[model samples]
Target chain A: MAVTARSRRVKPAGGFELAAWYFMRISGLFLVFLALGHLCIMHLIHNVESINYNFVSDRWTNPQTGYIWRLWDLTMVNLAILHGFNGLRQILEEWINRAKSRVVLRTGIWIFAGALLLLGNYAILMFVKDADYLKNRRDASSDAVTVRADVDRGASSRHPAAVPAFDVLK
Target chain B: MSVYRRGLVSRLVEGLRYGGGAGQWSWLLHRITGLGILLYLVVHIWDTFLVIFSPASYDAIMGFYGGKIHGVEYPLLRWAFRLGELGLFASVVFHAVNGLRVILFDLSPIRAVGAQKELFWAVVALFFFIMIPVTFIVIHALVAEPTPVAAAIVFPRNFVQAFVH
Candidate 1:
């Protein structure tokens, strides 16, 4: 491949675009682990049916390991959102040639991404389990264990026993 | 003279017809999966945000996922969402694995031209290797509560069953 004058100039002048390219690869490497691990934990290891507000409360409020999860979620949110939006931006740039429309669309994309990032981070950082909810969650957590056991035993009728606990939480 | 502006759909159709090779297909899939995940991420963030501002609403929203809220059951909706989760899982796995292949080609010391096809096939193999067990687990979990006999039919008792149980 011949390196034309334009191609050579890109290295020195591409500045932000160059940085965005490198960021995509680096963050993508990090997310491969972070995201797949998240999927395994949330979807594979634990049934989605088992998740609810109390589940989130329990995970985020645990005394010993909550902070670790918070940090993990924080990093995943920032990296994943930025990498996704940047990739979207690249796609849009390739497809949309008009300069003014491109600028508008790019700004809109960032605004949406920025707002989501802020909201997600705030939810993680500002979460505090109320005493009443915490106490109920503790009780429900034990009930959840029992529900899992029953489900494992092929006792379909026992499944609804888990509903009242979620009802109480609601 | 009127100018005919090419839209994104036309451009995409044209690109599809061009038929470069494995590289083009991989690039197209990456774009698609990336977009799907991003769309889900936006919804996920908003839903989680509800937890902080409205706990009751959060629990109610989760009920839709589980097929019940306040004692009402929507078994069909739950199945639909579970299937959607399976699709999302497939998308995430492919994107992650293919992204790794792209990274290796771009950043690694190895020469990419000779090995690109092999790397792509390796990614496909790994994707299925991961998804097969995962699909079983998800379907098992979905049917376990409603029809234990069917769940058993879907997933025979084995070591993997023991792990999940």
Candidate 2:
């Protein structure tokens, strides 16, 4: 921790890193409950074996439940990217203490975090609709059967798991 | 060193940094915890997505999780997984409460620098306050559940049963 002639003293440019630090403590607390609650619901209770496309469709199609999923998705995006970007901010704070570099780095973090948030939100919104397709267990089961048959044929022919040229999508 | 010594603000900032003041350590801890939590989130999401592909597959994947905590079947991995969850929980708790503190700092309706002192203790207080209960619940849930519980608690069992059946 000593400053030598070769090592210059680098000070954090502003209070943002401090803010991020405090933010971590706060977010960390909330995340414990959120994540635990999430785990209990998704993994610990009835087990994933019970979940299917119909399971998801039923959940999302419910007006109240859909809002809950939407909220969870938003919280995930907000906390995750912000937390990540803040970590990067600390790195920049440590190594890139100069004002000009700080500006550029902060800008980059913002843009990256913003993009991730947008993508996560889009996925959640699309999921509401996609849940419909997954609801049809019969169709999904047929697809699974077809895929399995293809795999069996490939196994007999000594073909790799890769799909045949004819099966390739455009 | 000379530059910092020449100005009050510079020296104060340097003191805060090297002195390991509340703000300084909070900043460092924030970075550490944030990265930790972010890593957890990635895996958590991937695991959850499996439920969408197929329930059977999802069960097959998760079947290995949450058994007797001290067996040769990747007991170390299991312990590590629990520890990682705890670590992420700690990180999340600290970050969120501290983030609110930061927000208040920005608002600065009152004395700004004075509030920084309280913010530090608040982080510590918040950590211990939340940790005790979370640790209790997590331990009880993990150990007591001789059988696997549901993947999600969002839907009660009765509701799920009614819907799925």
Candidate 3:
């Protein structure tokens, strides 16, 4: 009696499946730590509403901020996204039984996931330049001050209790 | 009073006990959680893209995530967020630990169901072992600790001089 894998469709642990199996386990572990740490800081520690552009910008490029946050975020996104796409590829193989369908679907998946990876890296790395964040922060601060002043000068009279404190924060 | 029950629950339990091996269950969980993370990835990418194009829209979405709809009852949303975080944590832990077991068994020659069962148990043990401390640290930081990044980022002399002066 030979040892058999549960999935008959998977061609008895062939090279591609074998490599993917190994990749899933290894990348899964990396994603666990990276993603958990990310969620810990982003969600558990800080309320979701607290994560405004300023907060993200600060984490990304502020000299006063450690580079670890940016690095951690980028690494987590890269690993998790790639790992996820790979896992989906495996699952789709099981679901799409037809060879032609599998090829078409896998090709589409590769293109989409690959494009997403590039776009994600671009948005994360390029948008976080300190100069840009600083400029936005300056503009935001001025806006905040103006809104604060408006409320102080009886802007509240216009809308009884509708002063948008949401707009004006440091 | 005994170790067994006698209804649909017992049938289900017995079925699970006899039905599939550890590999099956582990594979099932891995697929589920992988899909879970992928779903999050799609939304996360869209939201992040919003940051570069429209800060206002990004803020609006963040407000939704944060459950801040201008004076609505919040306990439900808060609990929902906490529960979702916990589920995500559990999924990550299980996927990681069990995934290691899978690789070990796959690489080695041990394919016996008994050994696989033991591997599954080991994975469960490790998951709980790591998660207990990780969960504590996460929740503790959330509640009592000044955000961890603060200390990491702040320059000590600059801070002391500026604040002290």
Candidate 4:
């Protein structure tokens, strides 16, 4: 008698899954380092709350300073977008069945992610070129300062300047 | 002490192999990196927004990263910055490659299980493939040690300038 072959079920290997699993642990470790250094420098050491418009204008005015700032900015943008998109992709895989509509949904989501990344990068690049806006800002600030000084010196005090008074029923 | 009972480590390995499908593992990693990146972003933005508020604060921030001084004798800040750069580099590369795996899965015609398995190893391969030069540059930039006396003496001025610069 001939024996029929019995099929055995084989489980899938850890595809990108294992690597991804390891990535989280590794990235988490690094993030702890980056975050602490970042906080210490930004808040604790310098206490960045003292920053203002001229402060930014002066900082960006330096080429090296501008470059470093852009580097950090891009790094943040790229990492955040990639990580968020990948996470969203995982969610889709785990939850949605692999149907046509689901694939389309994922594609659409990825496109949106791409768009957001591009927009963010563009905005950061443009932020450095706002010198005109900065000048206008300076003028406005100076006017405000002058107005405050006048007020402090008693602009509305008893001897008001030969100010024109509005007449009713002229 | 029971012969029939398995240890915790063995149990975890078994669980990952069985309960944790390849896809699940990758998904877990994606979430981890995702959250890490998000956390980094919040602090990054907050710190950077300083450029908008104060120039001195910004300079102080940059200067901290510029170099590290140990008393008046040694500068050790470059090493720290290198370490940070390496971390950021790794994060971006891993996330980007893994993201590609995700994109492929979404686009591929393969079954769910098959896609997961294929992408897992693919991600690993791509990660190292991209990391080679990055690792090299980072290590070269960061690690510092005293030059041998003979070598240092032979080119004292040059060596001193090279290291300092």
Best-fitting candidate, scored by TM-score: 1
Tell me how each candidate scores on DockQ against the true complex.
Answer: 0.41, 0.10, 0.22, 0.04
For model 3, the docking class works out as incorrect
Better of 2 and 3 by DockQ: 3
| TM-score for each of the candidates | 0.80, 0.54, 0.67, 0.42
Every candidate's fraction of true contacts kept comes to: 0.56, 0.17, 0.43, 0.06
**C-alpha lDDT of residue A60 in model 1:** 83
lDDT of 1 by residue, A1-170 (tens): 11331242233246888899789889998998999888876776555565667677777877767887888899999999999999889877766779999889999999989998899899999998766764674576566634332132222444322222122221
Compose the digit string of candidate 4's lDDT tens values, residues B1-165. 223234567644654554545666765665666666655554555555555444345444544553422112123665565466556556655765666565454445366446567668888888787577555534543342211122233446543543453
* Per-residue lDDT of A20 in model 1: 90
Task: Report residue B141 deviation for candidate 3 (angstroms).
Answer: 8.7
Selected candidate, larger DockQ, 1 vs 4: 1
For each candidate in the order shown, give its overall lDDT on alpha carbons.
Answer: 0.73, 0.54, 0.61, 0.48
Return whichever of 2 and 4 wins on TM-score.
2
- Candidate 3 off by > 4 Å: A1-19, A45-49, A64-68, A129-170, B1-18, B70-73, B111-114, B130-165
lDDT of 2 by residue, B67-147 (tens): 222212354655555565666667767876666666566557366567778778977998898787656555544554322
Q: Any runs in candidate 2 off by more than 4 Å, and if so which?
A: A1-64, A86-90, A93-123, A128-170, B2-17, B53-57, B64-75, B109-112, B146-165
Query: Could you give me the TM-score of model 2 versus the true structure?
Result: 0.54
* TM-score of chain B, candidates 1 onward in order: 0.81, 0.67, 0.65, 0.63
How is the predicted docking of candidate 1 categorized under the CAPRI scheme? acceptable
lDDT of 1 by residue, B49-81 (tens): 998988777867776776765636677987899
Candidate 1 regions with alpha-carbon error over 4 angstroms: A1-13, A133-170, B1-5, B108-110, B146-165
Error (Å) of candidate 2 at residue B29 is 1.0
